[model samples]
Target: MAATACRRGRLTLPAFLIALALAPVVGGRADTSFDTGPELGQRLLRDVVRIEARDLAEHGFGLVVGVDRDDVYIATARHVVARRAPAGLVEPERASHAIAVSFCALPGAPRQLAAMLDGFDGADDDLALLRAPRPSAYVPELKALAPAGKDGVGDQVWQLGRESDCVVVPTPGVIAGRPDTRHTVRVDLHGALGGASGGPLVSGYGIVGLVKRSDNEVIRAHAIAALAARVRALAGPPFLLGEAGNIPPGDPQAAVADLTETLNGYLFAARDLNTLLRQEIVPRPTFAQMVQRYNGSVNRFKAARDKYDGTLQRNWPAGTLPQWQALRERLWRIHLRFFGLNGQSTTTITGTERAPPPVREQMAALEPELAGLQSDIARFAEHLGKRSIDHAELSQ
Candidate 1:
């Protein structure tokens, strides 16, 4: 029963993997030669628009692909936009909303217009699509829509994206293999870097995949067809017309305010957890030992909490820290678990009891502190629950 209850408090690997699999990819590509000439580059350039977003917490860069009359969609990895700010700055009621995309005509050109993100997915994909009011001047060489097929091992493909310092580059590679339908290609390309995310992977005249990451300089790109199919499924018919339009600028401020609250809530929750561990939970050696067995779970939580607090103080809104009073309530629940204080009220001590008072009294004292910790955690969970995520939105 204890184990089952404890399991409720843990973050399962499968859940984390699902989240990671759904995170958005960011950055641009590096330059290399392609069989297609400069004309192809110019044509593709028209479809590719630089993405820039800002918020109270951070700013980021991304790319927009496929534009039409109604909607001009920007493609990027979902992680770029969905990533939470360091936990320190998060407050109970505030969330860190993403900044708008700053679009420019060309690589070196000044930002021309601002755009906003429309929607995204948080499962099985890491793609996002942003919408702009008007088309930017620069465009990427748009390849024909990919044929209905899957890339095979030894298939030759090409990728185009920007590298560090926003230098657009291309790379050529052969398909290594398909790990899964969602994670399509493992290409053998030269030196992939940080910025070359959300770029195109082409086989023949059609787009085969989107640039995702480079593992030890080996490019790990995702299949375009797979992503497109997911997007079509999620976005329905409207996005297909390329008629996606920008959300009004007035709308984001309120959303940002809400996000700020959510972030603060998460931070407060972390602080609460820290207090509980330090006071009520840590005193119980068995509980401490259990956490320690996980090689630094407790320590990591502490470090992560401290880091988040520092970030919150620097970037978050004032006067939104977690309530100590609420934290006390949560500590009570922790005490119950530590002492096995349920059913017949018999104390089942797991480890040696070396303290002054009877174990029952010690458990009772811990109740309030544990309750306090839970309050903060609950707030953090709430914040996470409210945020919207789309893994497929990150693809281009």
Candidate 2:
């Protein structure tokens, strides 16, 4: 259940994965699109809605936060949904009276969700929290950001945007610095385009900041939970979070490459040791111990995989489920062979040294399975990025 307290002072107002590129251009101009996840229904795009400026007839982005009883709350930049102040002034000229939101419930047919003025903030902060009823299919996870230590220098991040055409595009960037303690995060990237005004800035760990006002040389944003005052006033739970920096979309492949390389390193060592032991270049005890340690490492990975299977259960697809099992079982067999060789005497009662089986063959057999599993991980990551409603009031 969502705690109905302020949780902590929202240090700032704040703010993914690439959603699919099928979004049609709003105008005649050409545009690029994104794909957070298409095979599975995406939740990030579903959570983020396109906000239409009712009277102004303009378009912007809104992040779906949790709901308050009958109404779901959305956090966005005040200027995106407000009437701008007079020239040279900072405050909004007047509050917006009417607004409509669209949800990604059915493919190509966005369901028109709830509408409201619900809340706003002071002149200095470009923050607004609108309350509306939950949508029909895509109830979002109102993920939160770290209230403290949101990020360190050089942390990678994603800038999720909604163009005027309603196409969701995600760009890459980083946390350059924080000049003050007001939780103002200085990002190192180009400012978001006109229609992207209320888009989100995320890191792998969590939501760090809302896409506040920005321009060249002054890429500023409000820290996460900066709108707790407004959120509490409207009856929504403050985000439960920590140091922000949700992983960028590109990282899944990077992680796979890195993890597989580590396994390759281990495989290489095992083969070298086996040859050295057979040739008597290495003593028996040392070879045995090294092989045992390798087995232990493989077992550890299996334990972790077992835990993952237990936790996710039927959520995983049947076809992909056995890839991990196959990988682990292959390694387990290799481990047992090494164990047998380690205990076997070089003399073998016949005064002949034991030779390890050909290693390249094992690697050849393992590589495809390993690569396939890695690909599955990358795809699953894409799915999670879309389905992740970390802060939405989901029933787990």
Top lDDT model: 2
After aligning candidate 1 to the native by TM-score, how far in Å is the CA of 40 from where it should be? Answer: 4.1
The weakest ten consecutive residues by lDDT in model 2 span 12-21
Writing each residue's lDDT as its tens digit, candidate 2 over 1-396 gives: 111222122211110001111233233211111112220113245556667777766667777666544666677877766777678987736756667776533346544544445334444677777665664555454333433553656665565554643343455567888635665677876654455666666664455677776665335667665654446564334432222223222333223333343345445545554445445244444544444545434443443344334323343346444655555455545544443332224233123333334422344555554455445545544543343332222122
- Model 2 CA deviation exceeding 4 Å by range: 1-43, 87-92, 104-120, 142-150, 165-170, 179-182, 216-218, 228-230, 233-331, 334-396
Each model's lDDT: 0.43, 0.49
lDDT of 1 by residue, 1-396 (tens): 121334225533221112222223333321211224222333344444444334443333444555566555666655444554455876332222543544433555554444334444532465666555543454433333444533556655655446423333545577777647566578886665555566656554345667666654577766666666655665532333121111111222222233333334434443333343333223444333332222222223322332233323333344333432233234424423442433121122223322223434644565565455545656644543454433222111
Task: For each candidate, give its TM-score against the true structure.
Answer: 0.41, 0.49
TM-score of 1: 0.41
* Candidate 2 Cα lDDT to native: 0.49
Model 1: runs farther than 4 Å from truth? Answer: 1-42, 54-65, 68-70, 84-119, 136-143, 164-170, 234-396
Per-residue error for 348 in candidate 2, Å, reads 39
Task: Sum up the clashes in candidate 2.
Answer: 28
